[model samples]
Target: MIYDLLVIGGGINGAGIARDAAGRGAKVLLVEKDDLAQHTSSSSTKLVHGGLRYLEHYEFRLVRESLIERERLLAIAPHIIWPLRFVLPHDKGLRPKWLLRLGLFLYDHIGGRKLLPPTRTVDLRQPPHGAFLEDRLTRGFEYSDCWVEDARLVALNCMDARERGADIRSQTECAALIRKADSWTATLRSSAGTQQIEARAVVNAAGPWVDAVLGQSTPDKPHENLRLVKGSHLIFNRLYDGDHAYIFQNGDGRIVFAIPYERDYTLVGTTDQSFSGDPSGIAISDEESLYLCDAVNEYLKHDVSPGDAVWSYAGVRPLYDDKSSSNSTVTRDYVFELDKEGGAPILSIFGGKITTYRKLAEHALHKLGGFADRSWTADEALPGGDIGASQFAGFLAEAKQRYGWFPADGVHRLARAYGTRIDRILGDATCLDDLGACMGGDLYAAELEYLVLEEFVIKPEDALWRRSKLGLHLDRHAHARVADWFAARKEYA
Candidate 1:
């Protein structure tokens, strides 16, 4: 059987393409070398936001499209994507106040924002927003962006694609591609074995490995299309009380975000350093960690050191090489290289942010015209995201009311992780005891079963870390227990 679309890379772009193609009545097969979203997708700043900083680089189109997608994503997946107000504390040394104000004004209007509130001025000397900031910072501006469960976005997209008759394979690498006159034959290798699959078209959404994947098909055609920029993030114990996130402006014309994460930790990040090394298991460098700490210390009242970070992550962005002198100045917008000179078309994706992934999928499919039907993902809810178009607060209230027997905190976690599918996991369980053995933290047996049976969660890391961040909540013993559970399970064998 020939798939209509074969998508490589299991990040946001690949999953989004698979979901879009499958929903549009095309037979799609998506193969991920590692676990889904094990790298870039899971390691993002985790915001469905417009590139507010991209305005300085004159990326109006990207910003507008991102803002628009932010709204669309919020409606489709309110459980995972919701509004987050960002507090940008005004620093006298960095960007001028006038420039910040002007940028916020354009941000408010440019993307056709209606549901989210516009930007507002705040006095940093006052309570909530500015209470954690240093005394030197007196004023700031607040604007709206949405936070996303980045890995789950990829997972749910794959789930929806599978439900729509697409073959989703994790831990499967596309080793070779032989472009035929009418089709492309791909050799997919996994621990189980190598399997050759044929597809009418191929979408190379291989984030940092875009060139490598293309090189497999056209080894002689040298392509220097990606500018790999390493971005590192640190996770510290919760910094402040408020839910509002901070976007700090640095002296070096860059911005770092400190977001509320996992309900117990504060997520601080992202240094843009040029990286040329391999993209797997990338860890935060000492210099990058110190830079992040210093960047946040400049604005916050409480200073943090490298030792204070409990966890840190690094991801390499395969940005389109725009030949900008500095790494930070590279475009966040995506570019596609569609090659169809002698055989079946292959679209190679480069340089995209999490916010615009859905739209990026649409554009990618549109580029590979005649392979599938019209766009359908703009309105369709993701697999577990069909909790009506109602507000998240309303959905939470409904979940609490329906599952009154379950612990409120547990239900809340499930709601956030599985969304409407929480019911599917809970099933007929009327009490906590019905949830089978508690593996660790909120990691219950029933939830693990759902992840294994429904989502493609094969390893303990797949469940405890990527699919859900229960790893942060679980202790060393609990993590080991979960690992043992996976070891004994037949699925692991």
Candidate 2:
């Protein structure tokens, strides 16, 4: 097939690039070695916020752009992106309250924030929010940011790309790429065997393996230099009781976040360590776990440990290398390198974040100028995010009233995950029983069937872990039942 752009790596950058290009009337093909978002994209800190710490590095442009994009995402994907308030307890001896307050003031005025509330001060000794905090802490600063289902964001972007006439090939690897005079030929390896695609342009958006893709995707340049910094997050059962996430300033100059996650758990993480090995091999080290535990214990009254962790995941950040002395000091801002070899251009994306992906995609395609079509993805709503600028609660009530009988849990899950596409999935089914068995909590046989038939989900983990976090709530029996049922469906197909 002839495509205008071939995007390698189905992580957030690749997916977002594909979605934006496809939306703008480009023929696009997205190839992922594994399932979409099965890597670093899924393992994000899951916040759509301006990096408050980046201010220390004087990254004013990055912070300003991120702040703008954060609000844009909340507007476009309200179902999955919701506002989160973070509480940063003021440390008396570390940095003066005035400095912290000044930072917050700059953050508030960084971009013209519209939907989210402004920053405020909190007394740690007071009732409600402070009751759980340690007695030593007295003052706190609260600010606004948004939380995103990071994995789902990638999936939704790919789905939206597919909806807009893009071919999304998951579990497919680009084994080779050869430049034809005015176009490019990508040799793709999949279970079906090798196939060649002709594209006018190719995007190397592979997160940590960007250098690998440069070597593997084409032979023009042996490699493009990028840095892979390993970061890890640990999930523990509820650390305290409030909805607000705790942001702490460690003595080492690194910040840690104890964010409320998945109802019964608190997610804490992100250590910036220089890594030399493959990103796939990077996991939470024994020392890193101890470091995290100590960081959490520093602020909380109740200390935490690895034994308290329910689960943990690690990711490698593909940062643009400016030869920073420390990994933590490396810029989080993205860089684009355009190679106009073989008439067709190769756009290589260096560094970016979940918060800045939409803008990054827009900027990437704009850099590709003559090759990529023109359209604004900023104003566009992603797949399952087409409530057309309506209040989420209003949209929810309306969706429930419209599809009221399709098992309350199933209905909510479908609408929240797929937005308007839920109606198509329901089809002629009028009642709960008509939708099929309840595979688990909130997951129904109907949703699984819909996924296999439409969403390119093949493995149980694809549906359970990435498509939905039903695995966390599902018992062994429920997981097995879903697996067996999925296997039976595949057998018939």
Which pairs clash in the backbone of model 1?
none
**Steric overlap count per candidate:** 0, 1
lDDT of 1 by residue, 125-164 (tens): 8887556889989989999998999999999999999999
* TM-score versus the correct structure, for each prediction: 0.98, 0.95
Off by over 4 Å in 1: 388-390, 491-493
Local distance difference test scores for all models = 0.90, 0.85
Off by over 4 Å in 2: 217-224, 371-373, 388-390, 401-414, 425-430
Ten contiguous residues minimizing lDDT sum, candidate 2: 216-225
How much does candidate 2 score in TM-score?
A: 0.95
Instruction: Compose the digit string of candidate 2's lDDT tens values, residues 165-258.
Output: 9999999999888777778888999999999889988899988888887775566565646988888989998888878898988888888998
